[model samples]
Target: MELKELLDIERQGWDALCASTGASFYGELMTDDAVMILANGMVLDRAGVVESLRDAPPWRAYEIDDPRLVDVGSDSKVLVYTGIAYRDGAEPAFRGIMSSTYVLTKAGWRLACYQQTQISQ
Candidate 1:
């Protein structure tokens, strides 16, 4: 898939997270064996992620900024970007850079890995 399309998927994933959609919906764009490295340095596998996010608090807004694509191979690509997270009646919750790896499978583009690094003021 083109970089723009991949970026759109990334944005949609962020939207889904912020909306606190059910785990099943959140898992649709991800690989069954996907993993995520949280800003707190916690590593979570697909099941861990789904479980944790199943009851996550809703966010007021989530904006991904300056996404750039890195083609890894014929079947894989990586997206690097910064993002801002907003919550109702609270200060911005997260200012961070994120990297997500997408791999083409029989089901099309699916997120294989994701990592986030918080930016301190």
Candidate 2:
């Protein structure tokens, strides 16, 4: 797939995380062996990540900023970006850089790995 298409999938996943909508769609966007590194440095597998998102607490908004393709191979790509998380009646709760890898599989582009590093104010 083209870079724009892959980035669109990435955006969809983030949007679902922020809106708490389309849980199944989010789950389907991930690979079976996907991995995620949280801002706290804890690592999680596909199921863990999906479950966490499904049960995430309400947030007012989320934004993926400055997303760019960092690397790309024949069937995979790495995206680097920063994200801001907003909560109701509060200042932005989290600002972090995120790196995610996506692989083109038979079903389409699926996230294979992700890492988030929190930026302290």
Candidate 3:
């Protein structure tokens, strides 16, 4: 896929990731080698990422804002954004800024890495 097409797919993936009430679709979008650095400094691999979502209560709601895309090359790109995640009955909503890198693979564009830092209001 072209860089522009990959970016569009990534945007769709981001929305799916944020809005996923289940882990399957989200996990499918990530590369097998993908890793995520959580706001709490925990590092999660592909399985771990899926497990985390599987173990959490469904997200009541979520929103992503200011998604800025940076082209790293013809086949690579990075997206950065801030967002809020709300879970049923959770207090203080989870607010954070995230950066995710995507790379074109034979299977299409897959998330290579993701890192998120908590934001305090």
Candidate 4:
């Protein structure tokens, strides 16, 4: 697939995985060395992130808005956007804005790193 197509696929996978609240799908999309910086200031590796989410509350709903894609060439790109995630019985959590960088590898575009910051707006 072309670079843009690959990114689209990745975006779809991301949304689906979030909607499913399934760690396995998230695990599949992450590289072995992927790093995630959570809004709570926790830095987790691939396994750590997946394992933590496994026990977390299910995502009752989610919306990814205004996905902006930046091509870094050679099959690498960065996706920055704002998203809101709502869990059952909890108020909607607005992620404010976040950025996830993906690298195109033989295994397709695996997420390299993700950082999320809570927005007050």
Tell me, by TM-score, which candidate is best: 1
lDDT of 2 by residue, 1-121 (tens): 4668867877777677667863676578778888889988789887787777787766678887887886678888898888888877768888999898989888878889989999975
Candidate 1: stretches off by over 4 Å: none
What are the models' TM-scores?
0.92, 0.87, 0.79, 0.81
Q: Give the alpha carbon lDDT tens digit for every residue of 1-121 in model 3.
A: 3535644765565455556644675588788889989989899998998888865655566677787878898777888778677777876478998888988788877888988999995
Top candidate, metric lDDT: 1
Collision count of model 1 = 0
The TM-score obtained by model 3 is: 0.79
Cand. 2 TM to true fold:
0.87
Local lDDT at 114 for model 2: 87
Clashing pairs for predicted structure model 2, backbone only: none
> What's the best-to-worst order under TM-score?
1, 2, 4, 3
lDDT scores of the candidates, listed in order: 0.84, 0.80, 0.75, 0.74
lDDT of 4 at 16: 58
What lDDT would candidate 3 get against the real structure? 0.75
